[model samples]
Target: MRETRRQTFDEVDLLLDNARLRDELEPYRDESIDPSINRMPLHAENEYLASMLAWERAPALPIAEWFNPPLDLMPPDSLSDAQLSSLLNKTIERLFSKNIVLRCTDHLSDRELYMIVYRDILPCCEKMVDVPGKAIEWMCVEDTETWLRYYASAVERRRYQEERGMPLPAAETPPYRRQLPGQ
Candidate 1:
């Protein structure tokens, strides 16, 4: 219940919590943790240790299973455009609730995004991290054309072309734009 950021080395709760976390993280210790955390205050170090332990313990499961009863979607072809759009919005909300974010989505149509969520995202196994504000950003677009055009800026495209020695796709407007969550 005290203020968070200025936590001094005097608090018993923090010290106790840190002790527990240190023991729990002993087996899962990263070689670089000591050097990275050496400069931080004990409270900050405790938080870092806890997050590392949380990630270490997180289960790799299909994203849909993060939902209670698991999120099962009907085939995108089975639904009309309006139906698909409505369902997609609701599904995005559900995914956001479980800390799963969809990125690079503007390039695809409603049906295309919906199918990706159904076929690609839901079944894909990912670490369900317990860390707050740490969401899994799932990329919705697979096409390089879409990435170069809508997502990347002209300068970035040019740099990418130079680096990869490949033709850059001309940048263009994405067909469908929605005010989706966690954009």
Candidate 2:
């Protein structure tokens, strides 16, 4: 008869505990993927701080194995992918909720907000579409009939910046300002 090591429920529980321990150790394994909880305002008795300190002081940690694992150590390619997916999902959820709230408020028609968000605002946000995390961009429509009225606000802003000697975004030189070499 061959003797095999039979496992009990307690051993199974112990294995679960070990797996939990590994899960707990996951964040420390990757510095870049680690959440930056430091941005939050700190209190003397903050729970976050206490937990962070406690995590810092664990003994017999497989630090070397955790930090120096092979490329296939993680379940997926990178935690960045997880973070990006999380952000995009959250943004979509938030946007849906916000649309619901806006609809209920009756302050602005659904069509109005839809036009701004889709046509104008989304174009500006194209610059940030590649960026990680959630950001809401809005566009405002100006009702100006004449050229003077249309450009008055922009002119004021430019003049104000000029007067204050503030560095404004580079403006393209007018055709008149471009002197020919023979001139």
Against the true structure, what is every candidate's RMSD?
3.5, 21.9
- Candidate 2 lDDT over residue span 66-137, tens digit each: 122311122223335555445433433444332211111112233333344334332332221211222323
* lDDT, each prediction: 0.86, 0.36
Tell me the TM-score of model 2: 0.19
Q: All candidates' TM-scores?
A: 0.85, 0.19
Q: How close is candidate 1 to the true structure, as a TM-score?
A: 0.85
Q: Work out candidate 1's RMSD over C-alphas.
A: 3.5
Among the numbered candidates, top TM-score falls to 1
In model 1, the Cα lDDT at residue 42 comes to 77
Task: Please list all clashing residue pairs in model 2, or write none if there are none.
Answer: none
